[model samples]
Target: MKIEQIYTGCLAQGAYYIVSENEAAIIDPLREVKPYLDRLEKDNVTLKYIFETHFHADFVSGHLDLSKKTNAPIVYGPTAQPEFEAIIAEDNQIFEIGNIKIKVLHTPGHTMESTTYLLIDENGVETAIFTGDTLFLGDVGRPDLAQKAGSVTQEDLAGILYESLHNKIMPLDDSITVYPAHGAGSACGKNMQKETVDILGNQKRTNYALNQPDKESFIREVLDGLTAPPKYFGMNVAMNKGGYDSLDTVMDRGLNPISVEDFESFAEETGALILDTRGPADFHKGFIPNAINIGLKGDFAPWVGNLIVDVKHPLLLVADEGTEEEVITRLSRVGFDNVLGYLKGGFEAWKNSTKEIDEIKRISPAEFAEAFNENSKVIDVRKIGEYSAEHIDNAYSRPLDTISDWVSTIDDSEHFFLHCAGGYRSMIAASILNSHGIRNFTEVEGGFNGIKKTEKFPVSDFVCQSKTL
Candidate 1:
């Protein structure tokens, strides 16, 4: 028997592959299904089933396409009412895959249909548990996400999760391995450990949620400090519940190359968003006049999901050479299927064509410190938590995540210098400000990390009361 955890770093998500006696099963696959298909073909194994822990809200799952291709039925736990055909397994039901067995544990906390799959070997010894969003290494899934869809309060979900963990999962043997859907950097759970796999016994002792003595305390602890989920979460859930466009179709539409003339014309005709997925430094040097820069290196998909807001918004791409397909695949992972195409010949084509180009004014940290010492306004575009921890003195906090709401509040006449924890987020902020026609600003190169190294500016560690200048 072989069990493999296919971890995707960008999404902080894990998909599992299990093989027993030439029969295999997949759990929680990403949008792209070709890799899974290739693996099965290479191993000469027949896919028996595709298991989903829940209807995910973060990324669109590949269950539909995988099932269609392999003739494998998609399986979920009780109370899951997907629009498509699926087998809703009963709690504790046993499924046979060649020499092994998988037991369904109806753990409905992250969502009404959330379930964990327990793998039992040929000898009937319980082994690993695939605890989707129900349990992370260091934290439990947030209960607030399913309130609207399940028609239950977050408190109600939290209580159910408590019962699910205690009654269904915690009672299992300590030797069992725990494989979760997501790790750290995922919005699914707060305080998740960076490690994807852990022993169940270790989680019981170390995870804060698992140690909670009562349901009430668990609910309060889980719900505290949950910032609002990204706006595209509900849209992703809807697409997952109901079916969505095939990955082939999304890629075919997005990977088409368009000349600079057609790119501009398409933008003017359709008003599609021009997303530049280059590095932060390259983006700051020169880009299309209104292109939004969410670099491919940083948290690209989540940032796109947060800032774009609409899943079906027609988008045109300006990517580095040979990376157009990668950009499209990543976009499709987040349910952004309406991508029009990419700029043919890359951004250099536009520059060569004598097209109107815009550039962001980037200054060194020393230059920024010198400017700030004079009569310059500074805005630190880091999160409130980071701002409160330590920030440059007199610099106001305006996070890049909330840029849409507060972009209008910035005075058009005043010049503001922007910086984030690193240079990536500052470029994103600068692009957003440029799109809003507020271009009278200079971005600090290397952001606060570089700024703190220069002792010319005063850095305050105390929490500040006001965030706005």
Candidate 2:
């Protein structure tokens, strides 16, 4: 028997491939299914089932497409009322894949249909548990995301999660390996460990949620630091529940190369968003006026999901030549399937054609330190937690994620300097601000990290009492 954890770093997600004899199963697949198909072909195994822990909210799952291609049944736990055809397995139901057996443990807390699949080896020894969102290495899944209108509250879900862990998970063998869906960078769980796989015994000892003395404490602790989830979460969930466009079709539409003239005309006609997927440094040099920069090198998909919010928004890409397919694939992973096309010949074509170009004013950290004053307007675009921990003495705490809410509050007459931890997020913020016609700010070259290295400005470690300037 072979078990492979296919980990995608960008999403911080893990999809499992388990093979025993000539049969295999896939658990929690990403939107792109070709890789899995190729793996099955190379291994010469027949895909017996496509297993989903729950209807995911972060990225659209490839269960529908994978099932369609392989004729494999998509399996979920009880109470999962998906619009598409699936097998709603009962609690403790046993499924055989050649020499091994999979036992379904209905652990519903992250969502009503959340489940953990227990793999029993050919020798009948309970080996590993794929705990989808229900349990992470260092933390449990946040209970607030699954709340419905006037129905199950977050507290109630937390209590259910506590029961699920103690009843179905904690009672299992300490030596059993635990494989979760997400890791530290994911928005699914706040306190997930960086390690993707851990022994159940280690989690019981170190995971805060698993050690809670009572249900009340577990609920309060789990719900404590959770901010609002990304706005595109619900849209992805809807697509995962219902069906979505085939990834093949999405790629065909997005890979088209549009001429500069046609690109501008399409933007005007459809109001499509121009997304520039280049590094922050290169993007700062020059870009098409009003294009938003969310670099493909960083946490591109999550940032796009958070800032853009609308998964169906038509997008015209301005990617580094040869990376258009990658950008489109990443966009489609998060359910952004309405890509119009990419800028033909990359951004150079637009510049060569004498199209109006815009540039962001960036100053070195030394320059910023030389110009620092108590009265100078500054914006810290890091997370509130990071800003509160340590920031410039008088900088306003306007996080990049919440820019759409506080952007209008920026005074046009006053100039501001913007910075993030290492400049990537601030550049993104700068581009969005420019797109909105609020371009009175100059970005710090290396953001707060560079500012700290200068040792010229006063850094405040005081906990922020207020968010205002």
Candidate 3:
């Protein structure tokens, strides 16, 4: 038997592939299904099952497409009322693939349909458990995300999660390997560890949520300090729960190369958002005026989902020449399927055509230090937690994720300097400010990290007491 964890770093998500003899099963697949199809071909195995832990909110799952292509039955746990056809297995029901057996454990806390699949080897030894969002390495899934209107509250879900963990999961063998859906960078769980896989015994000892003395403590800890989920989460969940257009169709529509004249006309005609997916440094040099920069080098998809908020919004791309397909694929992962096309020759073509181009003013950390003054305005675009830990003495704590709430209140006449941990997020802020016609700010070249290295500015350890705008 072979077990493989296909981990995608940008999303911090893991999908599993298990093969025993000539039969295989896939768990929690990404939207693009080519990789899984290729693997099945290489191994010469027939796909027998597509198992989904729950209807995911972060990215669209490829269960429907994979099932259609492989003729495999899509499996879900009880109480999962998906719009598509699937086998909703009962709790503790076992399914076989070749020589191995998979036993379903209905662990519904992350979502009503959340489940963990126990892998029993040919010898009937319980081996591994694919605990979707129900459990992570350092923390369990946040209980607040699944709350419905006037129905199951977060506390109710938390109680259910506690029961699931203690009654179903904790009773398992200590040696069983635990593989989760997400890692540290994901918003699904606040305090997930960097490691993607761990033994159940180690997690029981180290994971805070697993060690909570009682249900009340578990609920309070899980719900505490959870920032609001991205606005696009519900949209992605809708697409995953219902169905979406084929990835093939989305690619065919997005991969079209449009001329500079047509691109400009299309933007005017369709009112599509121009998304520049180049690196922050390159994008700072020059870009199409009003284009938002969420660099492909960083956490591109999540930032797009957070900032853009709507998956159906039409978008026109300005990507590095050879990376258009990649940008489109990433966008599609988050259910952004309305991508019209890309700039034919990238930003260079727009620059060469004498189109109105805009560039952001960027100052190095050294320069920022030299120009420091009591009257200078600085904006820290990092998260509130990071800003509270340490930041420039008098900088305003305006997190990039919550920019939409406070950006309109900024006084355009007053000049400001912006920075994030590195330059990635600040550049994103700069572009958004530019789009809003508030371009009087200078972005720090290397953000707070660089500012610290200069050793000139006074860094404050005290939490910022600035009033929310």
Candidate 4:
């Protein structure tokens, strides 16, 4: 038997492919299904099952499309109320695929229908357990995401998670491999380990959630310090649950290249957001006026999901050449399917057309420190956790995640200097500030990372933060 974890670093999500005796099964697939189709064709295996741990809130799953194309049955654990036809397997039920068996263990903690699949080999020995969001490498899933479903409270879900872990998951043998849905950089869990895979035994010993001696302690720890999930999470979950347009359809509509005239006209007609997915340096140099910069270099999809709250928000892209398709695909991954099209010839086309262009002022960190010494207002757009850890002595904590709530607090008259840990988020903050007509600001080029490296800057020691959303 061959088992592979197809990990997508962009989403910090893992989808599994298991094959044996010319039969294959896919677990928790991304929206784009071509890769999985290619794999099946290459292996000459018939896809037998598409297993979903739950209706995910992170990204749209490819189950419906895969099932439609391959005639594979979509399977879920008990209590799943999908809009379409699916096999809701009972707890502890086993399904056969070629020479191996996959046993469904209904471990509903992260959500009401969350499940883990135990992969039993041809020898009839449990080899590995695919723990969706129920368990991570170092932390378990947060219990708050699905709290509104069935009018259940987060504490109630935490209690259920505790029972699910102790009763179903903890009983498994230590040697079985544990494959989770998401790793670090994901909002699903706090303080997730960077490692993607771990032995169940090692996890039991190392994972704080698993090592908790009592259910109350486990729930408290699991639910502690969870920042609000992104606004787009619920919409993504709904799309995953009710089904969404196929990736092919979404791309067919989104990948069209429009001329500068048509791009601007479309934006005016539809009120489409102009999203510039270029490098931070390129974006800072010049961009279409009023465009928001969420660079494609780092955490692009999740950041888009966070800032662009509307799942159906129409977007016009200003991506570098040869990256339009990638930009569209990543947008679709996060449930942003209403992409109108991309600017033909990228931002250059608009520039050559003599269209009005805007540029953000970027100052070197050394320059920032020099100006900061003179009493320029500074805004640190890092998360509360990062702000609390250590920051410039006088920097105000205005985290980018919840920027809309407190962004108006920036005085219209003051020329503020903005920075995040690195320059990426600060540029994002800059764009948002620009959009709101608050452009009297200078973005620190290297942000706090470069600021702290210079001896002229005053870096503060770690201090406990009291800010909360």
Best prediction by lDDT: 3
lDDT of 3 at 444: 95
Residue-by-residue lDDT tens digits, candidate 1, 1-469: 9999999999999999999998999999999999999999998999999999999999999999999999999999999999999999999999999899999999998899999999999999999999999999999999988886456899999999999999999999999999999999999987999899999999999999998878889989998988888889999999999999999989988888999888898898988999999998898889999999999988899999989989999999999999998899998889999999999999999999979999999999888777775567888888887888888877788878888888878886888899998899999999999988988999999999999898788778755536444
Query: What is each predicted model's overall lDDT from 0 to 1?
Result: 0.92, 0.93, 0.94, 0.91
Compared to the true structure, candidate 2 yields what TM-score?
0.98
- True-vs-predicted CA distance for residue 229, candidate 2, Å: 0.8
What TM-score fits each model?
0.97, 0.98, 0.99, 0.97
RMSD of candidate 3 to the truth, in angstroms, is: 0.9
- What is model 4's C-alpha RMSD? 1.7
Q: What is the C-alpha lDDT profile of model 4 across 1-469, one tens digit per residue?
A: 9999999999999999999999999999998899999999999999999999999998888899999999999999999999999999999999999999999999998999999999999999999999999999999988998987567999999999999999999999999999999999998888799999999999989998988889899888888888898889999999988988888888899889999888888899999999999988999989888999999989999999999989999999999999988998998888999998899999988888978989999989888767776475678889887887788776778889988888777676868788998899999999989989988889999888898888776668655433431
Clashing pairs in 3: none
lDDT of 2 by residue, 270-294 (tens): 9999999999899999999899999
lDDT of 3: 0.94
Count clashing residue pairs per candidate.
0, 0, 0, 0
